[model samples]
Target: MHSGLPNGEHALIVHQAGDLSNSCANVGPIMAPDKKFNVSAIFGNIKVDGTKNATIDREIDWPKDISLIGRSLVIHKLSVMEWSLRNKDILPLACGTIGFASP
Candidate 1:
């Protein structure tokens, strides 16, 4: 992901809703269909280089039941650990809806 974000590790999560009408805040909470938080909801962290670019060359092991088709991929301002420890405020830096490419 090429972003204007600062060089640091940022949190990546998939929200329940795909809505971006009111910015990332409208994306809703991390996708917890079971009404419980788990490893599935965490997409891990994206390390931004000095050039503000992040690359994930490996395939992510996603849960089969959770469909990310219409969900939103949110890039938080802080890393997962920082956000969890400091404050629960998930300040989003960027957001995009997950979808398949057209043929």
Candidate 2:
């Protein structure tokens, strides 16, 4: 998790924005029906002090369809599914585009 984020049930979503290119800014759900990225990957659930800072140690089962590279990670206020359906354009608390790591 980043150093700046409110403490709550934040979801980690991988959006398939464009044609799987560098301009994929859509930020939609990686799955269908319920736009849930991962319920268990809930951020801010860690125990922290007044500063509300804690590291998130989680192992996610990466889906084949959703590639980490060139994709975007969005953190929403509410549940991923709820926010996607209710709002015209979802507002993410924090977001970042995934890139390849140097070997």
Candidate 3:
């Protein structure tokens, strides 16, 4: 993903709902199907280079039972490390709903 965000590591997460009606606030909580709050829902951090672009080349491992389709992927203003340490609410910078790619 590319953004005008300051060059730094940011948090990426998958929320339970695909709703973006209220910005990123109404996306509901992280997609923790098994009630495991600390696991699958968090996609860790994405480092934004000087060009303000971030990429994840590797495949992310997620719970097989949980389908990411129709879910919301959110990019947070702070890195997961910073957010966890500071214990602050997630500040979403951008978001998009997950969907299938075209053939």
Query: Of the candidates shown, which would achieve the greatest TM-score relative to the real structure?
Result: 1
C-alpha RMSD (angstroms) for model 3: 2.9
Model 3 TM-score (2 dp): 0.78
Using Cα atoms with residue i matched to residue i, what is each candidate's TM-score against the true structure?
A: 0.79, 0.56, 0.78
Q: After superposition, how far is residue 61 of candidate 3 from its true place, in Å?
A: 2.1
lDDT, candidate 1, 1-103, per-residue tens: 6458878888887889999876677998888756542446666788888776785423577656667899999888888788667764555889999999989
In terms of lDDT, model 2 sits at: 0.53
CA RMSD per model (angstroms): 2.8, 5.9, 2.9
Candidate 3 structure quality by residue, lDDT tens digits, 1-103: 6568777888788888999876678788877767753346778888888877776534677767668899999888888778668754555888889999989
- Write down the TM-score for model 1: 0.79
Clashes of each: 0, 1, 0
Estimate every model's Cα lDDT from 0 to 1. Answer: 0.77, 0.53, 0.78
- Candidate 1 off by > 4 Å: 33-39, 56-59
Candidate 2 structure quality by residue, lDDT tens digits, 1-103: 6766676545566665423333333565553312454432233223223576744445566555545676566666555456546763546666677787789
Candidate 3 deviant stretches above 4 angstroms: 35-39, 86-90
Model 1 Cα shift for residue 90 (angstroms): 4.6
